[model samples]
Target: MEKKLERIINNYLYEDIKEIQKSENLRNLGLDSMSSIELLISIETEFDIQIPDSYLVPGTFENFEKLKETIESILLP
Candidate 1:
């Protein structure tokens, strides 16, 4: 899950992903409408879970790790 999350972020949104100290702001990583949509789709397909529209917004992600955790939490039935 961690690798998948990292791939989604690095492949779709982040070109400057770091081993440490990456930015917390999605906006800083060029999170426009298209990227957000791709994120939503990739997460849903990869996790086999539907993310509510309310949870897909920038405010919900907080940071890359936080986003990964949220997805994993949803996966843990």
Candidate 2:
């Protein structure tokens, strides 16, 4: 799941996956509002899960770990 998430995020980033720190802000890594939306769509499609409206916020996409946690919560719940 982590690898898949990284691959999806890599699609929108200029940096290599290895260079991205878990604590780094995705927005600073090149994810803008539009890309964030697209990223959400990609994640939903890939995971076969529809993220609730409540999860659609800046904080959800604030970093890789948070995004992973959000998806895992929905997927495992």
Cα-based lDDT for every prediction: 0.70, 0.90
lDDT of 2: 0.90
Which candidate's lDDT is highest? 2
Give the poorly placed runs of model 1, Cα more than 4 Å off: 19-23
Clashes of each: 0, 0
lDDT over C-alpha atoms for residue 72 of model 2: 96
Query: In angstroms, how far off is 77's CA in candidate 1?
Result: 4.7
User: Number of the top candidate by TM-score?
Assistant: 2
lDDT of 2 by residue, 1-77 (tens): 99999999899877866686887898888899999989999999999999999999899999989999999999999
Off by over 4 Å in 2: none
lDDT of 1 by residue, 12-38 (tens): 555555553444676567667777778
